[model samples]
Target: MVNKSRMNRVAAAMAVAALVSVALPGASAQAAATTPRIDLRVLVVDDGGSSVEAITAELRDTGVPYTRVQLGGSGRPVIDAAFLSDVVDGRPRAKYQGVVLPNENPFGEGSAEMAALVAYEAAYGIRQVDAYTWAHPGVGLEYTDSGGYSGQLDGTQAAVTAAGKAGPFGYLGGQVAFEDNSALVPESYGFMGRPRAGYTSYVDAPVGSGRASLVGEYTHDGRSELVVTFGYNQYQQQFRLLARGIVDWLTQGVHLGQSRSWFAVHVDDVFAPDARWNKELDCTPGDYACAGGEGKESTIRMSAADAQYAAQWQQAKDFKLDMLFNGGAGEEWKAENGGTDALTAQLVADRAKYRWLNHTYTHPFLGCIQDTTTVPWTCVKDASGAVTWMSRAEISAQIRDNVNWATSKGISVDRTELVTGEHSGLKTLPQQGQDNPNLAGALADNGVRWVGSDNSREPAQRPVGAAQTVPRHPMNVYYNTGTNAEMADEYNWLYTSRAQGGSGICEDNPATSTCLPAPLDTDTGYLEHIVPAEARTALRHVLANDPRPHYVHQSNLAEDRTLYPVLDRVLDTYRTLYAPNTPIVNQSMKEIGTELGRRAAWDKALAAGRVTAYRIGTAVTVKAPSGVLAPITAPNGTKKQLLLGTADFGTAYAGNRSAWTGPEPLQSSVTLRLPG
Candidate 1:
């Protein structure tokens, strides 16, 4: 009983359904058929400018792999559609997730290369960063001449906007002050302009009577660009502060590298005394070069009151300091002072309050036997002309005895961690050109896995037997000084010219030193000038994602407690500039060493092209060498795939979650499900 009209309607409905499926596909089916594969790599087009170099440096330092195409350089890769993207296995594949250009238009306006870049960005939904550019309509901003301003940005205070706080720069608190290192030299320069339609400002500064954008996002033609109106080098404080946000925005919160601000302070000579700096002789009394100063030797050692104060300060700041201690030195001091050291007793009472690393039994020079007959001591050599190095037994005893002593006092310490006195047992530039022959053997004997080195001398981590060197930054608060006046006087002696009553060292080494305009007033200089300078330097390291611990001496914790002012300023400024989500990452010496080792391995894997990471839809796949961990940063809710179920991807940091991760059990690669 088929009705002809009904049969016709049913047939027509079927045909319409087929047509609709062909024209507008279902979400899952469409994604499966044509999902875009976006590579977790950045393409940097360099114009040989400081701004471009600055961003490039950030990418490199953060362990984010990138390809550089030098503009105006011979044999540079052409910016063509085929070069930017391709179809792989019937799906579109973008070679780079982000593109960093020297400016809004690096290949010139209306050029084929520029056109190709624009088309590629639009097609792949790739973000671009105008590393540095002048404000104009091209970047969706009014010209500086029109109700805007352009000039040096040094000493200017910029601020993150509401839009920024809600976007990639959510980690920052608000203010960003440009550094004015020298009044005679211009450090930063920029142009500020009013944002036009489709432009959202991230960071802005005062312009005329109102605010204008310094860094902002401009959306147009199915693509977006992060436009930066400022000029800066990689070392500039402003650049370091803003680099993480720039990279985050470029990658859209998903990348193959993770970054966190790390800060750790180590107080060396914890149980020993530091020699006093002689203002009259312009040298430390106990040092080799200070002649006729033996009888006048005075030492700066922490007292029981200072130890109590240190514990209180740590509780107040919620920070822990690493104690690089010498057990024999403390015992000797105790014997000299009626066999009762109040400082030692106080520190032992609060043993669990601070981290501890072995600084040897006695703070003896372990590199070589010194021939002290010469003014600048030389290494002693045997009859055969070979260097006379401290024996392995002696070195191992120094390391072993200290750990035993700490254990006896019920103080928890990692036996694998050691920081030799003066970073000895390693190479000393003018005297010992190489590590002591016995040093490696001694370190291996003691089961030392992490040994501290001087960052100023050996900045890079290297192996010594089974151990790796954990480079530490020497804070400007001198080991010899326990007072502010001594620090200032020494600073003036090193930085001022002979005409200004200094040693004239700054005049001789102009490349590495800056001569002060005038000698600092010993009474007021350390608080006014030195504290800010040292704090700024330390903050720069923290902002750079450097995990190296900064080392000051026990002397800094005694007497006037000179180190607290600088530390307070650094911590306060850091808190003011960053939100709680981006808390400073503090790690132990061994942890820092492990981190550096893992980073080195990861970097090696990336450089050898042994790692591949890409995102398809909300799924990220990262494949690396089996033993190597992959560094990943993604949205807060991202989850890592497991053999059976998913797990939280990484710990939260800088407004995202990140970790050095490896594949789950039975999995071939590390895979993550990104938040929608």
Candidate 2:
């Protein structure tokens, strides 16, 4: 009496229902049961090209963890399913959160390696960055020969698309101008092309009668690729300006490390007069090279009016200048001029408006006593043929006296911060190649935690007794120049060829200097040439996440207020390029020193393989050696998980939330929950 046909129909119906459960979105219960673990690391496939190297440099500089696979290296690991991913505790795990390829495909078409990478990316929902690629349909763009352009991109002005402004590159303002460092040399090259289907342009440049993509995202086969057309090196301004966007996009705005534009200016020799540059002699009059110029020496110092202008400038710009004051030199100037020193009085009255640091008492050389009889001075030595160094007591008095002077004037100064006269006492290469033996003790005596060093000389921070050295960059604006003409004259002397009516130092140092075809006219050079060049250099440093303060003499703030032009350019250009979300991080010397120290420790931990971070579903976990702060950048709304509950994570920066963090109390690792 059994209905076999009815039973068969019921079985078929059951099978159909099961298939529908797997096919419909949000109904695949088994597939939704577990989310794959995505390791917070990037995979970089290097073709040994500058484009790949540039992105790798950005990764390294930003402290993002990445594994590099050299295509040409014999020992390089193979790209395969096993290498790219694995099953961990019965759940799928992606080995990398993102991938950076030299181009759309370094591996030939139909190659198994390329297939493996594509499959892995698609399965993990990970993004890829084609660091540099030609415009072609393979990358979702039409060939440049078709309604596009192909050539040098130097001096080209590119704009971010609406998609870019709403996504990873939101930090950047619309325009991105390619660098034209040398008119004779093509600094940048690229192909711009019309986007094909599945392609969305992030950045584009004018081509023909329409705009074509320079950078764009291509989606196909369930994966995305950020395609870049231009060729650039790590040091190029164009690359730097776009580097952040590339990284953010590749990682989908979630990864380790954080970046910020940093800019700080230190005005040295405050309250003191700086020896003027003698254009006629092409040397500073008081300097040893100028033989009979001592009698004709003149000094440039800020008057009360200049001091007032400086305060007003700071207020207008909303930027603080670090004033490295020399009390004894101000007193000497006062005596030389009149009993009433208006500059000192004005600076004291508005002291709270600026940051004050010790620049020694009289700005005397604190290294070995210089034997200035020679053109390039040599260190004075005693009978034993050993260098006769400035004593520790003398160095201590210089530091102590300046701090006391600041205190007496009710000008707040950090006793722990000092910038030695000329960054001396550390080393003066070729003459005093070693630090004065007594300098370290003097720093300790004054409780100095940070002392300034010249970045041009010793760019890396190092220990000095119980303190550390905070290197400061010497700006191109000459310390001896107050007026624009003087600055231009000195710049021309240093940069022009001898045949061009100037010293040929640039020719002698071909590796470091670029000689001008002709001398810059003193009248128009400072405004038209020098300001932009100096501003560009300084902006490069800021974009590179450099926290080192740029140093210029107080003389640059006097007379013409020449420093303002360079500073203005830097500020204005930066504002024009970056959005308000990515403001310049201006920190005190102590704060910068601390940040550098933390980064060093974190980098060491990462290098030692002591740091482990991975994202599982909406949860991120990080473990590092105790006391080492791990830098983490995650999408906004991420929360740090505490023992009992969770707290909002990191401060917002550059469209994401990031911070240098360690684990909470009673925890050995950091855990964060990403927003749904």
Candidate 3:
């Protein structure tokens, strides 16, 4: 009762690389034999002709056929949907699989092209990638006619950088420095991980739903030659792997839901205005009780004592510490020489638990304003009681500012990830993606290369994972998006079954409770809480594949000095690869985003009905039925198992006959084995 089709596809993918490695001498012929020879078409946007020729010369040597189309070159239409019309209309068979936009324009022309490309991607649903640039895409350029602000810099100097945004990524991947546009070409999102200067930070919000994320500022790394953000360049190869993994995800290279893994834990705050969520969230209501919490029965003062507890996180070796949510602006980010260095210490102590990441300064629910009615450990939202999100600039401030706070002061994530205040509101930044722009465009703009999250999808959902991430993507996708990504209290339909009027999660939430970031043990099965070991469990699944999944903590990349225990182990996963595939030497997210552009083309071709059959060696092929065209039912293991309330992801495990299940089909060489 199991299908091996997906397994076969994975095997084939491995074969493609195996072929090259084998031929490289001392490589495995079997690996090379399984690799499929693929001819790819490439597009070079805004390349000014010279770079296009350079790309052609370089890629052609790899045995992949290609075609280069420059949007910013002569005879090419501008970004007003002129050229894209032909491609999506299914007219002149667009041969390019991906587009690479690389340049250095202080006039901000690069940002315009990047924005246009993003728009085209959205209109056509075609993926676009911005290569390593001085700045993140759409930023450093002039504000758009619509007043949306596309340019990121203020002419000569970059007005913004991604130095602080590294917090979130740090929690999942290792730490890395972001590339600043000043040292590099200044293109947004093109060159993440470039060496950049760093600063110390100290911004903290109370634990609430209406705070902002702590971001970083970008500086330059003179040694590596590229402008860099903190912890970004520190782990360059991590991004190369990240790019590879993203490609795997886009090409269906890695089917999610195919494997069964553990839930990824998320440590964050609750929305309650009690002491726990007060100091940083509702301390300044200006009410008579402002000085005191809602009575002693429900008061949580972010006391200095918490720092002692947070320090223990370093030894929690149960799992990979795959992720760490900044949990709404607790009393930490704002920690200064205030009364209790204890709260300050605890704030930094949390990073010791796992890799630090960009959680946005103040951890804004992004829907509301902050309230500083109380002093020390008491902050609240505005009287309007309405929530608000930070503007693109504000969000950037949080990220950049925090990075400076953590790095300069000596406290931050190990790596960096791109996420949002609450997984639901992951903005494309400056409000672009909602208008149909490709999400990748923003990451490309900032040069963020590594995307890290480890979560499981609800039962019955198909598996969706990034292949290049190796040990990272052995299981599911949307690691931090929903309950599978992190636990949620909302109990949305995704967790319920349609027949039961929902995804079955609402039925499970303690039968009535509406709290998220659930406790370790919940009385209700439906409200099952996520566990800390969720990340570890997922790693084990990857290890099951080969006893040695490429495991890397989120922090190891940027600050190798801290991950002494795991550095050697992390490298061991690929130690056997021929030629010692040394890390891509600081591959930025922008570069990976560039590689993913081709993936968008493939998807567009399928969506536009232009591509029907993919002749995979004549025998292995993909073809939709006549007029009954639909994507092949590639069964990833998503639906193979039962839904156990996930941990950490802050998801509400609304139990239902539909969400829970039994064992799953094991197809990989590795299998999950729990130590009794």
Q: Which candidate is the best by TM-score?
A: 1
lDDT ranking from best candidate downward: 1, 2, 3
> What is the C-alpha lDDT profile of model 2 across 594-622, one tens digit per residue?
88888888889989999989998788999
What are the per-residue Cα lDDT tens digits for candidate 1 across 1-676? 3356446635643443344333322322433469789999999999999999988888888889899998988988887766877777777788999999999777753356766677667667889999999887768888887788899999999999999999988999898889998888988888999999999999998876899999999998768999999999988878887999999999999998888889999999998999999999899887777877879899999999999999999999888988989989999999998999999999999998999889999989999999877978999999999899999999999999999999999999898999999999999999889999899999999899999999999999999888899999999999899899999999999999999999999999999998999999999999999999999899989998899999999999999999999999888889998988899988999999999999999989989999999999999999999899988899999999999889998998889999999988888999999988
Candidate 1 C-alpha RMSD relative to the actual structure? 9.3
Give the per-residue lDDT digits (tens) of candidate 3, residues 1-676: 1136435534543443343322223212322344322112344554554333433333332112333555545675443333332322322222333444443222242244433344333222233332333323122311122222223221211211132222212111222222232343543222221121242111111112221111222211110011121111211222322222222222222111111112232333211112212222223233234445445323223344433433443354234333333433443534433534444454554644554555454555332233344333222335684334344455545555545545754655533344344432332232212211222343343443444222221111111122121112322112122222122221323344445334344446755433222222212322322221223234333222111122222212111122222222333332321012122111222222322333333344444554332212211122322222122212122122113322111111111001111222232111111111
Model 2: pairs clashing at backbone N, Cα or C within 3 Å: none
Better of 2 and 3 by lDDT: 2
Q: Which of the numbered candidates is closest to the native, going by highest lDDT?
A: 1
In model 1, the clashing pairs are none
Scanning candidate 3 in windows of ten residues, the lowest lDDT window is 649-658
lDDT over C-alpha atoms for residue 465 of model 3: 22
